[model samples]
Target: MTEGKRAIIQQLLQEYDIQDAQDIQDALKDLLGGTIKEMMESEMDQHLGYEKSERTESEDADRNYRNGYKSKRVNSSYGSMDIDVPQDRHSSFEPKVVKKRQKDISDIDQKIISMYAKGMTTKQISETIDDIYGFEASEGFISDVTDKILPQIEEWQERPLSAVYPIVFIDAIHFSVRDDGVIRKLAAYVVLGINSDGRKEVLSLVIGENESSKYWLSVLNSLKNRGVQDILILCSDGLSGIKEAIQTAFPKTEQQRCIVHMVRNTLKYVANKDMKAFAKDLKTIYTASDEKTALSQLDRVTDKWDGQYPYAMKRWHENWDAISPIFKFSKDVRTAFYTTNAIESLNSTLRRLNRQRSVFPSSQALLKALYLATFEATKKWTSPIRNWGKVRGELSIMYPDRMPD
Candidate 1:
């Protein structure tokens, strides 16, 4: 270090009587408090157009001047410190360094918001702030800080989407929230889309009273209003009335039922001893090279298992139209759209974050937590899906009129 700077440090050490780390922190806090006090005094002098105890020739009789000092305690990284804020007779002098009514001087508000986004409870966040920054942050204070993102969440939910999406996945994650002292289950519908460039994007998220095709219809209508004119393929679990909703919103869009969900549903009725063999036979139907071969395998599996599990075979026949679309695509495209794993993986992340809070105070609170977690989870979606080049080529051929150049 330079000799001049080194001397200044030596003088400060002597003046503060520094001995250890705690002493150094106390000394720095005092210095910071004094520096803020001096800055505010300078600001007051500039506002009054004269230095303290000095008179200017052009000063008027009714000019504004410093009245007295107001004691205020502010929290900072160096711990909490008290400051004597200068006041004016007219109350027109605003301090830029520490704005009026802003108690926490450090970036503690952002820290609280970050913690809240990671599914930390307000009480936990408050304790964390106290442990790390040596200050007590109330739960109410943390909630107020996180509420600042409500507008941002609304903007993101309403933002316009691309005119066309090559593929979209729709799914729901359930949460419990309090409504008039009664805890009820609610659904958060997540709509994820793959744009023409083949990148994954979370299009929208909304909280509904329950998981229903009616609520999904409204969500789809909102997407249509936002600018989604065409979606080549939409994949989802076999929820009742969802097909009708899709047909109503975008009649031309092809629907692909989630093969994983179908498998799970079929296996639900099969005996545990037979599940492995049953699943193996079921895989043959979906893994076939073409639709004709898949249908033949379906017939074979039906003949083998129908006597024991007729309902399982019945579900396949009932939903054959929705389940057979993947057979028309090549391996790469089929792999991408055959299941709802992309969106389900997203839901799993949300669920992991949501586990900390068993019941939220309200729907808005639940949405805020989810929005923050979703934002954090989606940060890694910086690139397109794997083998997107070939997938896009197949989509282009599949939907020539809809695919953008």
Candidate 2:
């Protein structure tokens, strides 16, 4: 100990009527015991037998800590703190901080979660813990810490939702995961809401096999059970049974086929040589001033292409009833519903995160990683949603009975 510190310690002890290391030690142990006793009397009754709260569970378990006189030392970033530990009732009291088998510091787990959420590999997290936190936390340890978030993710996924949405966009994207022995594709669907407050919220994520209506039926029904009483606009890229699913869950919601996906799908059928001409003609259909104008423009293009491509016009005409409603709205809202771009943006973020992970040992690990990714992604949802005012205004004029309560 430095002479200056020793002298000051002596001076303070003298003022407090003590001047020896043993006396100081005795005082601290007494103080800590009193603190614990008072705490137990005041609040421990509230959580005596049931599961202890996460913050103090470890603390409650450390009641048997032996009261020791030797100056107990714990190193911290600032340097060292020499404090006494009370061993009395050691089995009944545990401070979460510095508790036995705290395993890793809380900060180490947080750092691992942050890195893993950003798609860092387990090896990377291990190295990061050693470099940044001065501890070697293995990949499994990191996974275990992250696993704490799995139940939270499950709850979030199944949580209740608002009763109504003026606009809802549905889209699914596939991610590769190791299943059994081989890699398999798992589809994740996102439901985005255009709420009365004119903001977009990611309402839910549904994981399923393939994009069939049967799977989507479960997703839609899950939403309904969770409290989504109505939907006003259902936007999606056409998958078989999608329209049927929407009608079954929310009969009044108007469905808008994503023009972006439609345009891309249309291009697939055209020959390389015909794409240039087809693109020019198809532009007219999407740029139409109203549903009538859009249908007329589509008819002209379909009539021209019918002789060259027999089913081209028929496909557009067949889907036109489901596709053209957007043109009647104010152009801003029309543009928003013309595609499921809202969900696409979220999917893009997920893909960017997933491109980093090769495989997960278990579904819980994947869910933990996804939960972190969503947490990171949702922080960016600060901008007022696109054309929300005008969209709600127009919806008010059209669906008089459907505005959010």
* Each prediction's TM-score versus the true structure: 0.94, 0.76
At residue 325, give the lDDT of candidate 2: 80
Error of 2 at 290 (Å): 2.0
- In Å, residue 188's CA in model 2 sits off its true spot by 1.2
| Candidate 2 structure quality by residue, lDDT tens digits, 1-405 | 999989966775765656576567555545544454445433333423332332334565544333333334443222223443333333454543355443332355666778888878788888866665444667887777787777878788888888888888888766676777777777667778877786778888766666666767788898899889988888888777888888788888888888888888888878899989998898888887887788788878887887877765565777886787887787777876888777666677777756787665555556566668778887887875777777778888888977974
TM-score of 2: 0.76
lDDT of 1 at 294: 96
Clashing pairs in model 1, backbone N/Cα/C closer than 3 A: none
Write one digit per residue (lDDT tens) for candidate 1, span 335-354: 89888777766788889765
Off by over 4 Å in 1: 1-8
Q: Judged by lDDT against the true structure, how good is candidate 2?
A: 0.70
Task: Report RMSD (Å) for each prediction in the order shown.
Answer: 2.0, 9.5
The candidate that achieves the highest TM-score relative to the unseen native structure: 1
